[model samples]
Target chain A: MSKKRIIAVSMVLAMLLTGCGSTAATANGTEEAKVEQVGQDTTSAAEEKSSDGEVITLTWLNHYAEAGKQAWVQSVKEQFEAKYDNVVLNIETVDADSHKTILQTKLASDDAPTIFDLSSNADLQVYNEAGYLADLSDFECLANVDAGLLKEGQVDGKQVGIPIELSGYGIFYNVDMFNEYGLEEPTTLSELKNVCETLKANGITPFATPFAEAWAFSCYPRVLYDAVCWNNDGAFWEKLADRSLKFADCEDFKKQMQTVWDFHEYWGEDAFGTSWDSAQQIMANGEAAMIAHGSWAVDGITSYNPDINLGVFPMPVSEDPSECRMIKEPGQQLVLFNYQDERIMEAARNLYNLIYSQDCMRVYAEEAHQMPSVPGDYNILPALAEIVNYPAELSFSEAGLKRNDPEHEDVLFETMMNAYTGSTFDVNELVDALDTAFDNIKK
Target chain B: MRKIRISSLLYILLMLLAICIFIMPVALAVLTSFKSKPELAKSILSLPATWNLDNYKGAVERSDFLNSLKNTVAVVAPSVVIIVLCSSMSGYTVARHSRDSRALRLLDKVYLASLMIPFQILMIPVYKIYKSLHLLNTLHGMIFMLVGTSIAYSSFLYVGFVKGIPHEIEESAYMDGCSEFRCFWLITFPLLKAISATVAALHTMWLWNDFNIAVILLQKENVRTITIKQFYFFGKYTADYGMAFAAAILSMIPVVACFMFMQKYIVNGIVVGAVKS
Candidate 1:
């Protein structure tokens, strides 16, 4: 009797299951069909402009979602939409880490944003190689930007981006500490070491590297590569790319690595575990005398402690002070995606031009508090005076050769930390490992 | 009696230590959120000189707190309901027919396979598919993706739940000339209250705390989830830790509240879902 009952129950359950399965399949089919229709409608709608009595929304993507930057973007959106009655501006700001993947995916799809932020020279070249960047050589704003600065945004001599801001990186020193010690700003490698010894004797940490945040320490090697290594040979990058010149073969590379070792030696005890936020706070509170970072450090330090008196000087990476140069780069650049749609491309171009307008540039500079890349009668902030006037070298952080081995930066950082952590650190072995990694990446 | 008292004292001490270990970070975050930037620079570990409300105010304004809360609820509610309803039904069917039908066995294996696959691998393809379907940046689209991703695990829980339930109860209903549809709604579903609660509570928390899918699919600020909004507090060059902590505390309110309300159900549900599955 129990067996018979079980058989009956299974039969009823099977019947119920079959019936429900068909219903769900039908419902899903209907959903797909409706979504397909919506997709078709939007694709057709994108082709139709406001001239045809339809509002066209152009999407722009960026990674700057900070408080002040977001406010500036909102203002820009309002002003742009008001100027063009028919064009609705939609600006989407993703976090910087996720922005690259999101943009790459979107570009491959039909939903690509009209304008986006380009990360680095290497990233720009990748996009350019894919033919994804819209040629903006004829953009009106190009003429207003400094020629040297404008060249940074160019890929293969075809202008594909517009410089939005420019920043220079150097060693930010505590002006109060320097005055207390009666130490003039160091200009040469020997002078830098003497200053470190003075600070050590005075019972202050000479430098703060924040090795835990690998990218924070990466700027040291990046600037060192540009100033000490690449400065000697103009064709070094090309040779490295062709595999004829290895990282191990360069004498200057080893010297740069030695400077990194010295930096680790002078940094605070907990530098290996210090985070950016903690490091900035330490710098602001005068626990550390100097940090090798860029102009952006000023805002963070001041925000942490408004009364922080800070000064900037080029990092002495060479024996001769004359060879030392502050590493500068365009802070951010705006690029237009190749949408293959005439109306959309035209609207994007118009929006790009408007972004570089005098009023817009003023708002951007004021809100971001960074140096303006475009030509304008903008007042230089009092804090930027020391580094802005100094001789600068174009930063290679994003340049293809410097970014070849993705692991090279982190490995260099680890080697520096190991030197300070009682490890048998071998500079030659480190260079060989980087060269191997580069060769593997090339293959 | 003396020995029991001594043991109880030792247990109390251990419990207190456990409580402190768990609560210290959260307490620190709360304390840190109330500190001014200068005060934080002076000492991150010390109690604030003054209980500052400015960080909370700034965090709220910068994150668009009210809108993000609304958006989060709007996404989580529909997504959870859809996942529970569809997955429960599928689980019931597959579990009941598993013995007699190879098709159901195949379906069960497929779902089990899907559970092993990680979301990171599917993220790119999912984005492309959503874009093609015109689902990007839409609340409904987000709901759709969340439901699809969650169903496999949810159904697995439901399958175990349905199998544990005696078929005798449903058999009696069937003998009364009741339809299978009526039997499920009237008899089986009512008995599934425990597992349904588990599924609902689990998915609610998952959808609430989800960051990746929300960031990738929902690009517009107005449609962003609370997790995505919290990212805005951290800048590339500078981070406002006070404001970030404040925003974090704010985002936690709903999830904590949901858990508190479903505390009893969650405990029982997890136990039942785990042991039976």
Candidate 2:
């Protein structure tokens, strides 16, 4: 071979070897770096303070990027900084859609946020099991929180997080349209049916389903699931969790599935194609009398028409009005990562306490338009009057079920979707599917 | 003459249809971004009553567009340069040695195989690897993954282009006592410019529009890319879609600017990478 060929071949050989070498180096480098991080953490654990008066920065990751919530978080940051001259609060927010994955990744990494938002119920349970949470059982802020509300925030009988706000799921009706049609808020299944019939007769859509999105479509079924299954002494979820019960065994589930069918019939012609925001528009514009949604959607509707006279009411799925109860869940909560530094832990707790104080809760209630977890009186939005007055029940949220079986929520959501839309959906078939899926999940 | 005119007319019509199909969604977003919330609720497809810039202002303020733009450029520029350098060298080797040795042939085969492995399959493993390496939340970490994920296809292109070059040029250079490194750089590299340009343009497009790698690797507010910024912006303003649309449109500007800047090289690169090989 010519000299050029030899030169070219040697260059190729060297370049190819470098590629292979770098990958092995990357893997070995990874293991070594992790060991180094552990060493650093150990050495730094005892040195929590930054000399005498140097500012110690605490990083907080949250999902409250919404307009009003952002202000509330900013207020907390300002107050926390004001109280502790030696500390600075650094805030970062990721959107809710990707928050869980991003937060989980950060928690497993060395750079976990000092404070973060813990999704209520099962999400909290997962992190608690991993020892990623700082036990806030002795945190003073929990003292002022209503006992029942505080109890809901607990996992393994330990208070792991502080509820930022509480909200419930129900029907948001156009009050002007209801009054124009001389309709009273329905208190029973027959009454709801009659109301729908009357609205239909008046050339108005009784319900705007927002079935284009599966989660929104699942809202009514979820609320109905609470009323029917939850009224059976609240033991249904525990039985499901322990594998002693199956969805097929619940007679009330089938009855509620029929209400799912009724919701489908009442859904407007464009329901399958209309989005959640558009459905709110339909309700706000008085084209639809009601939308089955949660408290968060009140702002969504009011944004479209600021003067939209909206009111909330429980979906009367059962014949007996006494069985009706709105499904409530604590919205967002402040939770701390298990940090080794005592000073950092103290700073995070101080911030948490400041954020949930009665003064701050009042601002949160007024500004966020979300109900306070603490029982002291605050200005409640008129739209929430019906939900606040109605009998409320804490249902087995899918997130709670998901902690036991990761696939349970997916299987349930799919089943609900199929039940709502599938022409040949049988309750028995649905129940069998649910049972089979639950067993598979357990396996 | 009539037949040629008619054929030309048909081509123009076809191009127009393609353009319309591609541009309709972008145009809709632009139109919707100009509308108020009430107007959007009234009709999504209708022209705005007032052509307002409130959505754009809100999106710019909320998404922290300037900081994200700086971060995106910081990540993309260095990463693209690294990808081009590594892939060109590797591609040169694979193309020349594939016929001579099984090891080089196997190396080339691996590059081809890497192309088949989807990014999603590697997402978790990569995250774990990144975490262990202390590479999480850093622009350097993002740059590393972007270059790693892109090198295989780009090297594949380089290898093909390198193969077609006459070995006589490098052979003669070696006869004059030029070292392998010197000969490859002075002679072979200059010859590989067309393909190198192609590789740079192609990977720039890939890295510029990427969300998954950046989303997984970069978590800090100071290091966020435009795609993740827009994702968070839309999440924040889901109830206010006019503002979300404005943010979406703003995010598209950088990618479009990149394509426009690389347009000449891109068209040539696509042709050369596709047909010349």
Candidate 3:
């Protein structure tokens, strides 16, 4: 009796599963039919271009917060749409770190957006090599943009991406706190050390650093490496780029690593565990005297405490005090993908032009509080203007594209991070690890 | 009498210590939510010097708290119900029926084997299947996926429980000229109430707080569930932890309330299912 009952139940389950499979098969058939219809429509539209409406939709992928006060994106979108009635804009916002991962996945799947943001020149190079982005050299908008900024977006001889904004990373100090402690902004490595000692004597943590995420410490070594190793020489990057020079062989690179290792004494005891948010809070609460980050923090600080007085200074150099080469890069770039529709391409160009226009630059500067790539005298907040005018390098130094190959570049910093945080590894071991990793990538 | 009182006091102290260990983080989140961004930076663990409800208000407004609450309920409720019904029926059949056919035995083995396969490997394929069906960003589609994945394991538990139920009870119902469906629904299902309740509670918690599928399938703002909404509140460059904590607190309320109400059934279901052959 039990055997017969089991047979009956098994039959029921089999029938249910079969039903599900057929339903899924029908769904696939419908999807295929839709794809065919879309292909046919595209062909017919091409033949009768004059008769069909010329409106085009450009899909933009960016990493911007969509929550309250999205004035930055909204202003740009509105200006573009108002100028070109036939253009439709679709923007997809994602987290900055996740954007690269998602963009790579989308590219592999062949669902790439028409325009997307690229973080580094090496990233621009990778996609350009893949034939995934459009060449912007022919575009008339390139005339007004700086040649140096354009060079950051070029792969080989072709311009593949457009610079949107520029930023400088260095130490931003609380001027009021510095005044209270009777200390001036440090101009050299030794002076900076003395100031740190003075701050520590006054029961204050001198520098706020968060090693929990590990990436925050990357900025320290990058600034130091640029000051010591490159010193505004283009040959340094050229050699590093083609793999002729190893970062470990450079004496300045070692000194830079040692400088970052010395920061452990000035940082919080549990700095390795403190997140960026907590570290920022520590500085905001006046527990720490200085924050070493990019100018992006200007808005974040003002938004948190409107009354707090802030000052910006270049990262101290080891050799020539006057040669303060601040590490600067375009905040991000917008790259267009290949689309057959001429109208879509035209609309994208129009939108691109509107964003770079002087009028839009003022709004972008005020709202986003970021340095506009285009040269214009716009009224910016006093504190922001001060940082904008701070003596800084506007071109890619040793730390820009040359140090940004995803496969080879990441190991040097990762090893440095481990070494700096009291990991018992000799300098030779660190150098060997970096050389081995870079050599493997060359293969 | 004094010695007995002293022992009771010691037991109470131990319990209090455990509660504190568990409750401190949650208490800090709540307190931080009431602080200004600057104040929060000063003392993340300390009580607020000034009470502020702005973070909670901001979190709710930014996350679209009401709409997400509705979407979560719509997906989780139907999924919980469908899984309970399907698993109970399948479990009842497997438990009561002892079949000899090779196909029948193979099907039983497949059901048990599927429980071992991790869901991560299946996520992409499952998403492609749903996309083809035009069900990628819909609440119904999400609920359907959850129910399908859940039925296998829930049915396994039901199968064991149903076997322990006496065969005579269902046999008597069958002898009364009742249909197999009616006999199972009227006689067998009532006896498996404790098991059903357990499945419902477990599935309710799982489906309600699920973040993985919600992120993969739903892209539209109107259809996003609570977990996805919480993620949207914090972008890459900026994250308001106070608001994130508020959203976390809000998402837990429904599940916690359900567990509170159904504590007895959940306990009984686990105890009986464990002891059964």
Candidate 4:
């Protein structure tokens, strides 16, 4: 052979040998399946186990602030491990915003985690419909969960995931700031307007709304949708789900938009630029008098200033008091995947039982500053526990009610926000656009 | 004279305006990095209230900036050397021998054809091959892949430059009892310096700032490059904007520094390579 041919053949041989060596190393060192698949199997197996001595590793993925809080994850993991010596709990934290994309990619690759948290009911429905989540209908631990919370996890008569907590959003006010201005929490839409006028007159911003984060604008429409359209027959949620109702057509939605527009004057000069976290901090630091957010902000507020007196009130966007609805959605869920192994199923069931038990719920409520799904007289932080029984109008997120229709929810919310932001298009036009998007998806 | 003076003044004004416009985004990013998160959120484009180093400190800590910088250099340096050496030698042989051999001409055509294939289409197959070889997460593996992908194009350029060089130089050296390898290296290699420098600079930038390959191949935290580190700084819902910007600025520093130091070589080399090719 010529020198060139010899060199070429030698190079090819070397590359082939190197490739074989690495493949053998990877086969030996790494887990047999991808990381996500391992998570799924482990979760399913843990659910099947009856008793915990088998030492099943359960991975919990979430994007909550507490997820990144080393102290919180370690504490929860330690508590669970201590209680159930046989089941080892591993926490895989991801950012909340990025979790959906990551989860979708993993599921496509069949590498989904055995246990992952879903932020919206719509997401739970999507996963349940796709058979990605295991049905927990017969799990006794769910017996004490609130019917509403349980309903959030159900898709087509099947309970596919477990609800861990519940949260509500209205208007959380700084009591000290309110007292300084001698203002009372508005009980009616007119009173709310008057309060804003009064605060503006005193040279203080009445509300701090961050429109930059589109979700922040969601609070106004969510409460109004509940107050005006929701009925005891569940026609409100059903109409929304079926696209039989147009938010702009509803007089209540128009009134709510008016209220939102009126309050725009009091949102301060740079309201459009303020971010959700920055707005929260502004409220916590007394830079703003009130912020419209969920009960989740309680811990953050107290942490910002231990002595800052905080008060909560339902958003009274409706002229009729009886029609007012506080916006809410299901908290995170503990889901199980169907596993054939009897032992694995039993182990997972036992783990779920531990998670839902009164003891675990109490720890979750107190430490996490969250409302437990289970019925319990748990000692929660004073501010948070007090709001648990607060008589604010309640409305579930439309996203939760139409969990299977993510495309619809995205359109509805996007259109609603566009209208609220002074888009020149009429509500009918926006609704028509949504209908087109939904129809296209259905086709 | 008056019209010429006015044209020169207009040109200067336009140049200044272009520079300002080009530098605006970089200036905003640097200013925003110095601001606190609250300040950043409040006015992303405004001047910072206080110039703070906290964001930079946080970015360095979170991104492991120094480690990524080191890994980036480790990948780029050797890859540059291997590409420059291999492409130049191969280009010389191909250009010199193609005049006499049909096989050399065919090889030249193959190399040219390889350049037309998109990098994205090659990524998965390359990754699978690398994975099978256990080269997925190693700096050496990355260097090997970079060299493999870059060699053909670099060699194409080198071949063109070598073809332009007078063959009489190599012939005279061969007549002096020098071996083929010695004649080529001692005579043609020095003459190929400009093209070599151009290839080296381009590959250095490509390998140093590359995100896609590094992300797919490197799973281990210790081996991640600077771009991967920047990406990992942002999470699903929450982004450490300050740190993201700071990390971005930091990642550009080494490349910028390298470019500044070699600016003269880069310009002259590319010009020479382009003219000869």
Q: Which candidate is the best by lDDT?
A: 1
Q: Indicate the residue-level lDDT of B158 in model 3.
A: 85
Candidate 3's residue-wise lDDT over A318-414, tens digit each? 7457756566666677788755566666777777787777777777777667787776797765655665575545323322345545544566667
Reference-based lDDT, residue B59, model 4:
83
Indicate the worst ten consecutive residues by lDDT in candidate 1 chain A: A24-33
Displacement of residue B74 (Cα, Å) in model 3 is 2.4
Supply DockQ values for each candidate: 0.35, 0.24, 0.28, 0.09
Candidate 2 chain A lDDT trough over 10 residues, lowest sum:
A24-33
Q: What TM-score does candidate 1 reach?
A: 0.88
Q: Which of the two candidates, 3 or 4, achieves a greater lDDT against the reference? A: 3
Q: What's the distance in Å from true for residue A380, model 3? A: 4.5
Model 2: per-residue Cα lDDT at residue A200: 92
For residues A1-443, write the lDDT of model 1, one tens digit per residue: 99989998999999788544321101111121111111222233234455569677777788887777887788889988898877888888988777766775565444557778875566567666656578899888787776667766778879887778777778888998999999988888889999999998998889876667767766656667766666666566657766789978898888787677766668888876888888888898888899888788887888888888888887887677777777667767888766666777677777877888878777766676677777577664555655556543523332223333344445545655555455446678777866775576568
What local distance difference test score does each model get? 0.76, 0.74, 0.71, 0.68
DockQ comparison, 1 vs 4, better candidate: 1
Off by over 4 Å in 2: A1-55, A241-243, A246-249, A389-406, B1-11, B98-107, B113-141, B171-187, B236-239, B274-277
Give lDDT tens digits, candidate 2, residues A258-312: 6777656688897668888788778777788888888877877877888888888
Which runs of model 1 end up more than 4 angstroms from their true locations? A1-54, A375-377, A392-424, B1-3
